[model samples]
Target chain A: MSESDRQGGEPEPEPERTSTGEYVLGGLGGLLVLLLLGFLIYQAAVVRDTGPELSVTVTGVETAGNGWSVHYRIANTGGQTAVQVQVTGVLSRDGTEVEESSATVDYVPPGSRRSGALLFSEDPGSGDLQVRPSGYSLP
Target chain B: MSATTDTEHLATGVGRAVGGALLFALPLFMTMEVWRLGHTVERYRLALLVLATVVLVIGLAHYFGAGPGGVSRAGYLADAGVALVVALLTASVVLVVLAVIDPVQDRQSALSVVVIEILPAAIGASYARSQLGAGSRRPQAPRYGHEVFLMAAGAVVFAANIAPTEEVVLLAAKLGERNAAVLVVLSLVLMHGFVYWVGFGGQEEATGFLRSFRNLTVVGYVAAFAVSAFLLWTFGRFDGVGLPVVVGQTVVLALPASVGAAAARLIL
Candidate 1:
């Protein structure tokens, strides 16, 4: 290192040119920041939530073995995140509860969805199969 | 020949930047809570964080050039821009490799994940390319305000690394009021020692033991504490907690953050 440099003195003169490419890159970078900030503000303004509003829907039913598997999706529409979400699926025949199963999702963030499946000995298609989120804890 | 040399020099700078980003962000990348926080953190706060990071990078790039460019207003802006790009790219690649985000299916989540990791990586990138690259230019001595800002930046880097974990909350709950007070005093003493006594690079001139202590050490600790509280709040650690718990958690995180502040003055 030069003595001047060692003493934290003035740096040795060197070319300090600002190339066209650097200008363009800087413009692009500034643009990216603006766009990202705009999107985030828009999202914040538009999306309103009181708490975690969770709902479950049956996406599909498939035969995995002697019985059938009920594929379900849990969606949280609220603003807050829910943890240890318990999604329960019930297959009832003639208003009598026949088979029931529940799945636990570790997390379901707001405006996000998680998928799981519940299996039963009876085909859910034959019975009135209902899938709904049973309960959840605040994250 | 000159143009070719410039291209080669930029390539080397870029290479070191990638190395720095990965090296600094590795802990965060592997952290499970951070992965979750990527998607769970409030959108507005995330946006503010990105803005803060941009401003910080520009400040850092002022001191440390991103490449061989001499210090100029436009040059530093461009350098800051390049560092931001390097940070984003590094974050995207690493998050994908770790399977933390599925960009194809989850664009918003992926963006959030990338944004959360960008700050530290950008700092590392700027620091590496400027200090580690060949033909490195020595940075100008920072003013007092910038020195404090650097301490806050360092505190953020260190505190963010550990804030997402459950341990902060758990430890705070168990620390009790007495131990918490002890920890606070210990943190202050350590910070004072590191600021003056420890033979770290860029050590501030000890005008007097009490003077430097009052100025840098006390101020730095306050900055670290504020930074710690902000980070914990951003991570939602203060969501449903009581005041005592919040204070304890802030104190817990402030310990490392204070050390980080001290170390930042020394190293950065």
Candidate 2:
């Protein structure tokens, strides 16, 4: 395919030629395109569109700076993506709400997980801790 | 020796296609916004996007493809088919290596991610096959309509490279009306400069300033804006935004896209 292989000062049309390798690669490529497109079509036909379903679980609590940080993992299990997800953590001491901390996750894609932390002056370990998704906007 | 050489030529063409896929699509593969978009984008939309990509790739291959069997109707078709395969396979491998998808567990997600990536990768493959391969063939001059389409394709590449990130939306939110208007003028000036003054290979014909600006640069920016809006919508960037934000984001993305459009004229 190099330019030097062709002769003369003017550009002569190269004779048509094909090798076994070209046929093999080309055939394989064609087959793959058909299969991939078919699969996507199948998915589009069968899957139902759904909105984002979000859930938050507290993973751990640690001392961060002057406060205790409540680390949480947020997951979206539905079809859509959740943007600006708000996760709120409440630490209650003896049935009284002592501290409320919340964090905002940028986005949580369906079937994916994102982690964030909330800080509170009172240690979550000293009280009954409850973490839940407050709200989220759709993308 | 001739047979071996032909086989080597095919191999080199395939190799360049692979390299081109990476060259164009690596940014999107690494972007977190795109990875999220894979699962979030509607299934039918993703499927439709695949079909659109197929059509665009075939058109591009007609101009840039080496056509291993010869530059005939069947030759470019074969080239387009191979470019699609190379693009898909290359995207799959790279996304997997980057842990962008877990094929076994995130099966639905993996499919969507690959589908989204296919367009840019396929275009890159076709471009590489035609332009970078040994004994590259010079394509015939593109018609006016084809020129606009090339600009749109270039816009897609540049816009896709950046649209998935949060910065577009954030930048739009902050750009305000005055800055956005300034951005529009800046994009036009930059596009015009690249096409006429930069002296890039295959520069636009130096028609009189007003005529060239009116015909090519202005039209190209409009095409870039439309392409940008489509891209942002595909990534769900327009889903929950106000009208002003939508317009602002479109203008922001049109900046890179207009540059790409101008570059396509010079390169493609």
Candidate 3:
């Protein structure tokens, strides 16, 4: 066979070589991406510091003919403002239901306390009262 | 190309598209299924049901549809099933940790909040990353991740509208007329974020942010939101259906579409 016919095709050009700087830059870019990912994770996990605890005190319990009045004292023990404070509780006597009520105080400033009363009709022979609070996290 | 080549190409493209769609839809469907399961059964049972349903759907899809011409079908199904299971497992872990540490005594709302709000967001993030090739060494992953982040950020901001408060008093004080309008606009932006992320993530291979954002998935969400709004206005519970419910429904619809897109992209 003729030499030209025997040869399949011309040789292809060689692939370009990457520079050391290019490789290093690529590696650095990957590292930066990884660092960004770590930062995102940290941001997601970090919880902002919430200020202050609100102290709730049951001031007094007074009995009347048909019902009893329970008094509350809500004090902000935190350095932040507390808004729309609602105290809820059930009054039980001798392990039986006496009454349930809630009181709402609009806003309580830092280092301040507010008092309110709620009345329940069923007489509690005499039992300790407990109060509970629920609302969005205080600002 | 030859007829056979053309047919093969068409099939491959369809397979890729479908796979992407399934990937995008799977997470959203799983989220809804979880929410439903939570309402009906115990947490353990809900987890079991989700797993079983996922396995069954994938197995059946593969068995029924995967054939000589359906290689992509089986692969996409598997991808979607795995994506959902991973997302759910991650969510469960997060929920368990939250419960152990914080112990939300009011389990109902707490569970609902996590399943509905937080889990979806996380899944959205992961889906975005996966699309962008963050989970793989593929060049497209970072781009996908960026797009996903943008979409999720948008959705999150939009969803912030419904933060529970004591009453309208708080709403009145905080959300003045101008503020409310701004919030509504922000919510729209958020919805767009989710749509763009999911839509782009669902392609056979992840595309650039602009391309993905303009895809059918994002368009579908925006369209659905608009249609739902129109529907509510015409025949919803108040004189007009409330915006909150409308937004919620829009999000719900968007979830499945996004998952389907992601699956399609991954599998195809």
lDDT winner: 2
- Which tens-of-lDDT digit does each residue in B190-226 have in candidate 1? 9888867776666566888888888898999999999
Better of 1 and 2 by TM-score: 1
- TM agreement with the true structure for every prediction: 0.88, 0.76, 0.29
Two-way DockQ contest, 1 vs 3, winner: 1
Stretches of model 1 off by over 4 angstroms after superposition? A1-13, A16-21, A50-59, A76-80, B1-3, B132-136, B139-141, B201-205
Instruction: Please provide, for model 2 over B1-268, each residue's C-alpha lDDT reduced to its tens digit, 9 standing for 90 to 100.
Output: 3877877788888898999898999888888878878767877677678877888887786655455543676667777887888999999999998888878656777888998898889888888887743334554555788888888888888988888889999999899799999999999999999989988777666779998899889999999999899888888888877899999999999999999999988887
User: Taking the tens digit of each residue's C-alpha lDDT, what string does model 3 give over B1-268?
Assistant: 3556535533443344234333433343343333322222223322332333343233322332321222254343433333343343344455565442122332432343333332233333223323321111222233543334333323322222221112222343445456555554554454445434455443333257666545634553454344323322222212334555445444443343334333333332
Whole-model lDDT per candidate: 0.81, 0.82, 0.41
Where does model 3 exceed 4 Å of error? A1-139, B1-71, B99-110, B118-129, B132-221, B224-268
Best of the candidates, DockQ: 1
Q: What share of the true interface contacts does each candidate keep?
A: 0.45, 0.48, 0.00
User: Cα deviation in Å at residue B150, candidate 3?
Assistant: 13
Candidate 1 backbone overlaps, count: 0
Better of 2 and 3 by lDDT: 2
Q: Which lDDT value does model 1 have at B189?
A: 94
